[model samples]
Target chain A: MGQRPGDLSAPARLAGPDEGIGADELALATRNHGLPLEALRHDVTPPGLHYVLTHYDIPYVPDAGAWRLTVDGHVRTPLDLSLADLLSFPQVTTRVTLECAGNGRALLTPRPVSQPWLVEAVGTADWTGVPLRRLLAEAGADPAAVDVVFTGADHGVERGVEQDYQRALPLSVATGDDPQVLVATAMNGAPLPPQHGRPLRLIVPGWYGMAQVKWLRSVTVGDVPFTGFQQSVAYRIRRTPDEEGEPVTRIAPRALLVPPGFPDFMSRTRVVRPGPVRLSGRAWSGQAPVSSVEVSTDGGAHWEPAVLDPVVDGHRWAWRAWHHTWTATPGEHAVGTRASDADGHVQPLDQHWNRGGLANNAVCFVRVVCVADACWP
Target chain B: MGQRPGDLSAPARLAGPDEGIGADELALATRNHGLPLEALRHDVTPPGLHYVLTHYDIPYVPDAGAWRLTVDGHVRTPLDLSLADLLSFPQVTTRVTLECAGNGRALLTPRPVSQPWLVEAVGTADWTGVPLRRLLAEAGADPAAVDVVFTGADHGVERGVEQDYQRALPLSVATGDDPQVLVATAMNGAPLPPQHGRPLRLIVPGWYGMAQVKWLRSVTVGDVPFTGFQQSVAYRIRRTPDEEGEPVTRIAPRALLVPPGFPDFMSRTRVVRPGPVRLSGRAWSGQAPVSSVEVSTDGGAHWEPAVLDPVVDGHRWAWRAWHHTWTATPGEHAVGTRASDADGHVQPLDQHWNRGGLANNAVCFVRVVCVADACWP
Candidate 1:
């Protein structure tokens, strides 16, 4: 092969200073950016079907033989442990619904300048790991510690700032009796994929995914609150850079309609024979258990309560499945769903406007055509 | 659960006439938009890892019990065959590389306003299908037929045009003993996934993905070329509305550098050791087989020929792997690769600008940092 003159040099200009790379570069930086929204139409999301978001191209897979995790800082004892050591600790497995802080960012009016995630940036997974509280207790935390910071292996430049992936939580949330906060090593009963953060990752159940740092390398307990780039800069919900916006935490109540996905030739709606059409979906809340869910079939003009599955093990992080049976109809129709948590937070008709578009629980509606018969024109 | 005041009615406006839905709508309409660029770094893309581009939300999975494939139009005898009948025809399984016509559209200067794909919209798969020639012969295609039109089950409004997904090829290419032209029933040894087009889909080897209609319903031979919405309007390349631009077909020769995606703290380059590092990737062409591949280590100032894997067969639809080894010195470096086809069509330094941003075969480069010893700091 001989050198082609224009080929090699032209693309280099794209990386130059004058022409700043735009959304296209951000879109290309990760392998699997997000999952298709249709993926949410399923109750139990398959591991491969799960959505993925990363700070960088999937970080290198560390050699299992040499990997280590360190816990240090204001604690009485600084602990450095191998993967084997961590595994030996009492293991806990729990199902948790994780939503990215930027989940509904795309729907934000005047859209936030970020990953442009749609509704599919959320998923529920059965994570297996050691509890973070147990690990912190073993390290003997200092009383003066105010925040616990978790660091990941992935790093990149974003908004002209270079940093490794880092996020923090208050000491109270980190060391609580809730066994749901885990140092997850496996997802869906299998070892975490590299993109999902292999070997070790933090699972801050109920909070947005940003707190669940992947490829966990260190945990530091600090006397002062950790004001890391990811914590104070990127994920904050502020209109301007000067404002100290609220840190996004705890997902809002949201319910999705899992249609049967049958195709209809008229009006972009799924076609179903005139009979009982079973509509089902999964719903969850970060701060409380989902108390109930409601469905609307006439463009929100009418609504009905849906049956909710019994909660499993009083886990606040897990999502509850909801089902509603719509009786026979033979015309165009739209289906919408909403959920209310025990905390009295009902899914909103319209999302509260936030600059970052974080925690948008706006009700989602799907259109379907109820056909008289199952015959194609 | 009772209906909240604004919750039900608010979201109805999103599907309104004034404000057309944006990215969130587009993302929900397809199962897979494009492959993550990082996924292209792998040699044999896993079945699930393959990129998917569809006209609609994976059209409701067709009922296998009622599916049929009809062959008519300009044929001496029409044939409506069931799944079993088509499966009984001698199967021809072949590995083929499929690239979206809009593959590198995102990188175009003054970027095209489309799916915004950036280089990862290509993959190779082993497809098991009955040859189109066999099917056409069985139906007795008419001597006057000039084009063969393939129609898919998907239909929707794009660019204000409502129509079913359709495309066509000259009768010569359709029925010419090219075993590569397939009526694919399976991919990678399993039944095709709904997202990838279940039951049946057409595989026009070496052509851009648009020509490979999914959820194929019928193969119609016509006396004249087909002028459907997807064929005459959408996939064509033109700078102005008045110009009846040429239709995009056949994959172009392109090369990509598959770097070891290691993490580097200093720059966004892959981290490597201070010794020899081997870089490799795949290259392919539509008009001809990949003749050779070249690598550039110091930007584009120097180039060296890389070893290309022997062609597996005369099938020009598949890709060939290329590898290059470089003696490394500590520091950062950019790696680039380019390929030339047997037809003397070398990968372009810069892609020619197109209105729809189709047929982008520009060269690709990757960056890496060589560290001293194995220390990250």
Candidate 2:
């Protein structure tokens, strides 16, 4: 719903190629592409509207003197390669979307404190690069070592706590193939941008942006976790704020905390002729791939099945477009979409707010203005 | 473990911050601050070093522009001011840790695919900043709007795909004392460096790095969410990569995926006259705060409570450091930490893996070197 013939009233600004969230721009309405409607505006998230995260730091704008991916940690052949060297590895390409775990925070209830996201945290693109697994294989990392630390170019301190923006991933996640994660140098068919990790970045199709460490640096394989400031105690949750006295673990998986429908704006219009209307939208899974998408015309009582679009198998990152048609006789109507993942998990309806905006996967909903079928009266 | 006279060789020459992981420096060692005698060493993660995540996109170089704090989400009146403005309000600080969601990946059986991060994904720090909840009151956002979106200046559009660094917070979280989210413009005592968010950056005491958007831009208040790709579909699970139709909806809370004990390389150097050797470490929560931390010395056998370090009540973002001594008889011991939050949620031993490394909270382990006092003969 971004553009309508005469809707020049809406801002028609194009995000500069390099400009991310401009320092001066005020956040108004925003959403992550990976999030659902109630949580995010699905269709209208423009290209200049994606989200990003770095493991250690932001795009290094690496000094030409030092631009390499060093393979250290517990490995047989400690290796380091220049950007040019990465090019020599067999390149791989896949269309993937990187999202931040906290992407859909805008809609969560209980009201947690977090980022002021302008819709567009999720971004899907054809990523071309070297498979990190391929590199691990070539480097001959110790199979016993399970963690892989991905350092970024961004740097700084967080209090007396000198810290890095680095994060770690499991060997399994590092080598899976739903989309086959990779150290991407190309996105959507172009070279990476300074804001998007120019020389190299990780393209982890179905993860929160943090997993797709923006600026790539060294990949350390180790026998034990490095416990860097970022990996040891951050990004966690327990049952409640009062629950943890010693150390707490993490938040449990919850359904997309949407109202029931998504991208309602796309279905919006001052005028709507009712007849056989095909309601269409997209549904996806964060905890697992979605199996079915349910739609409700009436508030929440009965639900009708909607056809799901085809997506690459097990590609949890890509979303499935869904559609359902309804006979018309309209006044006002409510529509909602609920996704059920392969794990029998369905988008939930509500979530009590906690301190950190951890996991809020509630059902999504929206109100619609319907009109009677046009006819000669 | 790093320095011991009349025993191990003198500490290896300290590698310059810019130096790559080399031989002597290959095995990283750190004497965890609070813990004594029981030091551990790994091939990565040097003490005095950890990953960092800054909020601003611009480098933190001494510059001209003054920094300000903006509070507009769901408030009655939107407020924007500079670093001076934030400082004028009030100042507060807390010790906290920020770990990447997928810190222990190599340990996952079947080896999940993604960045093979072995070590160095955790860190701790004392943070100082103005409480955000108070600012929201100052801004006067509508009470009905329960969500606030935070945008950042670091923007990137690659191959028609645009990604921004942003996040959203629930009203409860934004205005709370515990978790006590901060609009931080400084680290330790110094002004935030350009590498970090110079003028300002948010310090969400608890939660994954994904929620901590760097290069923050603006904040918006709304009754419902404006979904972006990141909010809905990413950071989810796709149970069983083999089968897929629609992806799952829920966003699992981020947690530490503790790996099996590092029983290898590390041997018990003490424990000759085993008595009560205090075991201490840190644990944190994401959505909710931690209630208690328990330690398991015999795999999942019996559990004992650890003395929790001081942590502010209602603070979900901050972690509770803990200590508990255990008497041992030499050989090898598996020490693990598991915690529960206010919601009664506890950490598990395993978690499902996805292509993208998202919320991976599993009870983690700690291996100790307990040698029988060198078999003093």
Candidate 3:
């Protein structure tokens, strides 16, 4: 059953430092998970290791063979395609990095009581699918259409508004050649896993994860801007409830290091050996390719340029690897990293706060204590 | 560097309701995740959707082909085998259900501040591998051995003690014919995923998740009991920290329903239509095959029998499906479910309190509100 607008829970509130995450928030965190920072070692994260944030129940699509994708609305000709029909189209594989808009939401001073994600809310995947432009061209799209809305089978209520989990993309981006969007059918050379949208899903390269509508069912072209609940209400950067905030779209530049050495089970404080250590991590941005990455051994107080790996062809949307070698001394220290995109967009030392805690691309710092080998068993 | 016994964090403490989950706890929850309750609909949960609780980082197993498994200690002949060696053995695949000892820990009165899992810390998977008995026999296992300690490559510090992650099983269980344990190399018919110990892992049927060691490296047959931190200190049932609590082993009898209807984003409250709703869920127990399941519609004030699906051969370790149909009227109601095993171990209505909060299998309740169709947008 659909939920009524009046059948709402308490309005979203920021939790103070002393305020514990409520049972409701804990429930969300338990089901949705972030990629462990150490998983950064893999160029293409295994499907199971990739981050996931499902807003609703993973719909049970028992028979994918019978699933169909419908394309209509503001089009010269409507088209209905089955899984087999979609498979018949020419396929393209793209390695793309997808990051949640609220990746560092948990680091905020008074954090938005939502997923409470840390820097781990990101992953790179090999997505294979039919380009949206090809599907739209075959369907005879109308040039007058301003936006295209994608709908997923998963449904739920958000802020008291019941929706079919719809999100709209500007027609330009939907049909553009630079960063082509796709009706993704496979991930990492295999059919999409259930949590990644088993039967079908939309893959918008370089865009934040929210734009990649999953468990896709239909595509609708519209003349006017499609202002659905997901597009107009949620995923926005607002300072106040009544403000018409800027929309959160592309991922901001960010760099996260694969924590060096072993971890303490409780505090996750890293313990390292005193010697030459090679610190490495991945950096990326949606606005442009990451051109430079900086390492800070004393947190953000000091910085040094790190060597960047050559960007490979056909993987511009994926993260670029960077590494630095540091001669360590035995003591407690903080290590940090940041990135700058080709467009000159740099990660801020401290993130700007917003009511919804969206697009937090702040520098990441890891606390480490270097000691002698004899300290352990 | 390994952590010293003196470099410890504060001892584990149970959190009162008002006290918030510590940042350390949130850090752990973000990296580890539980299975979504709705995923129970699938008989074999997809590997990606399966529950994962890694104590340390998912070690970078760069090349599974080059990985080796060593069987030594107390064996008549030490055996060093490569991945190909393990794969060449007689292969066996079994569907087994695994539940965490801390499944319902968060629901306790004063909860242990760990992963904070609710009722979702469980999943079933088809594990393919070589039988442990076959491997032990090939290595010439010593019949006088009392325990078999399995070691994983992933290493970190727990309770200030630095060591490789390890767990031990009784000699009989390791080489038994009834509930065969496996040196699993694959999951769900494919090579084991990275998070699931890409190279190798141990799968002990009918035991709690703690007994399943991922990222396996070596096996040591020993005459003395294994006293690792994970085996003796953690995963125990105790009244106080000083008590030598009983070791947690098998899964308790429990049932969890696929929460019906749609969920509200903030509170996860369920909304349903006024009609006949087919309530369904999965139930299981490690002690024995699930013999019965019951459904309660009024906060568990009363319960009625639910039909159980017949168990299939070769998959006796998996959960059994159960279903019940409820004709509903428009109003708010609490729906609950409970299960009993063949050994007469029934899920408790209220779980008993403990220091570590392990093996709690209390009834699960989902609050749902029934409304008319017009109530939705």
Residue B115 in candidate 2, Cα distance off native in Å: 39
Model 3 agreement with the true structure over A1-377: per-residue lDDT tens digits: 44455665567788876787778888888889999999898899988778999888888988999898999998888989998999999999999999998889888888898888888999999999999999999988898899999999998877777778999999899999879999999999999989999889999989999999999999999999988988988899998888989999999999999999988887898878899999999999999999899999897888999999888675999999889998787777799999999999999997799988899898879988887777655
TM-score of each: 0.73, 0.42, 0.98
**Per-model root-mean-square deviation over C-alphas:** 8.4, 23.8, 1.7
Candidate 1 falls in which docking quality class? incorrect
lDDT of each: 0.72, 0.51, 0.89
lDDT of 3 by residue, B235-288 (tens): 889989899999998888899999999888778888788989999999999899
Give chain A TM for each model in order: 0.88, 0.74, 0.97
Worst 10 residues of 3 chain A by lDDT: A1-10
Instruction: State each model's TM-score restricted to chain B.
Output: 0.88, 0.67, 0.97
Q: For every model in order, what is the iRMS? A: 10.9, 29.5, 3.0
Query: lDDT by residue for model 1 over A278-331, one digit each (tens)?
Result: 888888888788999999988778789999988767656778888889884766
Best by lDDT: 3
Locate the minimum summed-lDDT window of 10 residues in model 1 chain B: B5-14
Q: lDDT tens string, model 1, B332-358?
A: 677888989889999877778777788
Candidate 2's docking class is incorrect
For all candidates, state DockQ relative to the true structure: 0.10, 0.01, 0.61
